[model samples]
Target: MAVPSGDQKPESYYVGVDVGTGSVRAALVDQRGTLVAFAEQPINQWEPQFNHHEQSSEDIWAACCVVTKKVVQGIDLNQIRGLGFDATCSLVVLDKQFRPLPVNHEGNSHQNIIMWLDHRAVSQVHRINETKHSVLQYVGGVMSVEMQAPKLLWLKENLRETCWDKAGHFFDLPDFLSWKATGVTARSLCSLVCKWTYLAEEGWDDSFWKKVGLEDLIADNYSKIGNQVLPPGASLGNGLTPEAAKDLGLPAGIAVAASLIDAHAGGLGVIGADVRGYGLACEEQPVTSRLAVICGTSSCHIGISKDPIFVSGVWGPYFSAMVPGFWLNEGGQSVTGKLIDHMVQGHAAFPELQAKATARCQSVYAYLNSHLDLIKKAQPVGFLTVDLHVWPDFHGNRSPLADLTLKGMVTGLKLSQDLDDLAILYLATIQAIAFGTRLIIEAMEAAGHSISTLFLCGGLSKNPLFVQMHADITGMPVVLSQEVESVLVGAAILGACASGDFSSVQEAMARMSKVGKVVFPRHEDKRYYDKKYQVFLKLVEHQKEYAAIMKGD
Candidate 1:
């Protein structure tokens, strides 16, 4: 990558930093949404105990600094117009004076972040769900253990002496990043409304908090969490603080946008792209016709509508959660990429497969896809998973069922532990994830969203097999963004909006997002996938039956 110089007429650019599950990735994206420079740095994650995931705010901030500096290495700092951040909606804790507060009883104060995936709040979530609070209806009728309310409750009950009692600020990670950048404590509506129980139209419900026994939040008027909220692209405070500017190696006072949840940032990046000339039905329809499926460590199916569309188990229909003036319904599969990694890495033939993949200079998944093609011969690769099926709830179902007790199940296993068996198992896992997406789409449509196409981004979208399987199984064309890291583009879109370079977020999205390619569903594979989906549904049915029988229900 060439260093962008100020020698020539300075060009407008935005810096987007994305904090993901396992790493911090930064991109220097031009106003046109092309990623000009990119860098990545891995962040630390600790499983101090099972189901309790924690990270350090200081460590994450350091990782963000590393990537942001690297991406801007050759760029003339003057050319950078704005900075934006998107991160996992993990909970970050700090003292009143703004010092890290330990989320765990024994861990260092640096380990203040309770990761979005942590399930320590399971009991708390169940109790909250039992309340049937009006807020529950906004969050798919069930408050997920993954969300902040339960996590906060868990802290109050279990870590009061160390954390909850002493804590002064509880931030969704995305908001924390913005506050880090601009020294602004206001939270983004994207985080507050989506993850916390802050309703976009009415703000927080005091009764719900008191009912859930976290009324301490109400006493402060929700200031510890967030009292003031702004939309995702709104400018924060005056801009980057001098201290943060020095840390990030960027100009002080550069426009810093109020950020978005990482997945929603991905949604903002690709969902608004001009899809004309793509020969897709979505081109002729309203933007509401397209669903943005941001698939990375997990997958979120976000679709926008003109009004609140109530899907029983799909979170949202929140106003302006992603796109302003649009009601966003977010459906999700809690673990897709992670589950794939678990299955592929845990198999008995994994060692053999790894060696073969390395010799071919390919990712294990790519190599496995090629091997499936080679073995399937004239038959379609999808046929290889005919006897095998996977239920991918290793992290529990996030949508369309809202059930957390569901465990992963695999049917049709032979005694043999061969490479072929491993490849087929990998294929089965991918198909199952696609089936999950299909279920989510059905739920969304049944509620009111007329989704005609899927706009895909995130790491999984790079896999041809994954993209094709989604297209084939969902029977919708998958549109790929010209900028493969659309989440970064989405983050940059926030910067563009903050800079006032565009009138609204919608304009920025239209100008920056571009269609790179389209994968059309293979109609010939329809019957096969339909049958597989039926079997996929049955697998979960049997899982529930088995659970009932064991419980003597």
Candidate 2:
């Protein structure tokens, strides 16, 4: 493809690539962090067996190339100063020749990636947790089936011949992309500190790996995983390799910054913005007062403190995880947007809802929002779900409780199965997610982090009802970033920092990020939600009780 000649292109432009669970997206952002052009392409996934989600590193890189090329189609190549990538904290396996290794028993080498949502390692996670190792403390005092260690142990035990024995290098998806880009073996601190139990100060823990029965990694001085670790936004090697530059349609040797996990990128994209003009409590307070909720397929409630605040069942207190010079605490729901989709789409009235949504040229969610308003007439939307309550852990709880075995529960069912039923269920699910966020907040405060402002971004944040519900339930103003694609912008901020256009990630965030709209909690509705939140707690408690009775407790 020939580069288009435009009238005086900007002095510098950065490209941001985000690989979420479903799709890969690329955005061309200017030096000021404004998105100039964007494109997306879906990545492929395979489920060879139950609870096993896998992808191909080859396919992901190809999708990245396609989106990046399309987004920069008409831009001058010389104007592109740097590039950055952020992906889900999924694990990628490769052999000595940098070839994909089968992560599944099917022996499909193309499906070499173990997805972030995959839970085939539950047995492994349980065994590791039984050890109660000190390294487990960093990951919320208990390792969820999602982290790399559990997955690694599972591979060592189950897929030894198919994967473990053949695998030469292991990579979190973000580090895989950087290695693919610059041929650098260095891993991002963001990935290691948050997901791999790599302490920022002490590096890798040999005893932890040995105790976990994966001492093979320590044999080569941690070469298979990562030896040279760099912080996010730090430039790697000389720059992009000739092959990667060709695939991405960019100049060779352009700056490529160390990457971040997708959610942390969203945190970086919004949390550090100076909110002085927003008239929120955080305006007078510090960045510590703002909590960034990157809500997408899952929701991660990210907050930073000047010092470590240990909140049990919540991940972090990790230094420089999201923002440099701060201790990061992350609480999350394993399912939020995905839960809403599952509940809405599985309803009997979904066909009618889809038809109505298509006829109105609106999304199903948009149609539902309007439908709820019509039903409520003059009443607040929260009132529609007065009798209906949802527990929202269909995919398991990620925070406060940190229990993967806990299943979702829905109370107040009726014989009436219609559009109204679907709408109310939808409303209840969103409220459940909001209450989960509140639980995380209460835990944080109990641990001594004063969070007064809520910052939201991601696909779910685009829904007005979802945003408003979070504000009302939490009783805090929710700040929305001016840029809707804040994850991409966060990746670009890393690029901007690597390009030397900004001094640090903090400076880059404050300069490039801006607050657009603020949703304030309605005090009048506070009493109502306070009561519903109680019911939310009881549903979980009762579910646990039922499980115990069934098991002959």
Q: TM-score of each candidate?
A: 0.98, 0.98
RMSD of 1: 1.5
For residues 498-517, write the lDDT of model 2, one tens digit per residue: 88888999999988888889
RMSD (CA, Å), each prediction: 1.5, 2.0
Model 2 segments more than 4 A misplaced? 1-9
In model 2, state the lDDT of residue 165: 91
Residue 237 in model 1: shift from native, Å? 1.0
lDDT of 2: 0.91
Tens-digit lDDT string for candidate 1 (1-553): 4454667656799999999998999999998999999999999998899988999999999999999999899777888899999999999999989999998878588899999999999999999999999999999888888999999999999988898888899999999999999889999999999999899999999999999999999876788999999998999889999999999999999999999999999999999998888799988999999999999999999999888888999998699988899999999988998899999999999999999999989999899989999999998899898889999999899999989889899999999999999999999999999999999999888888899999999999999999999999999999999999999999999999999999999999999999999999999999999999999999999999998899994
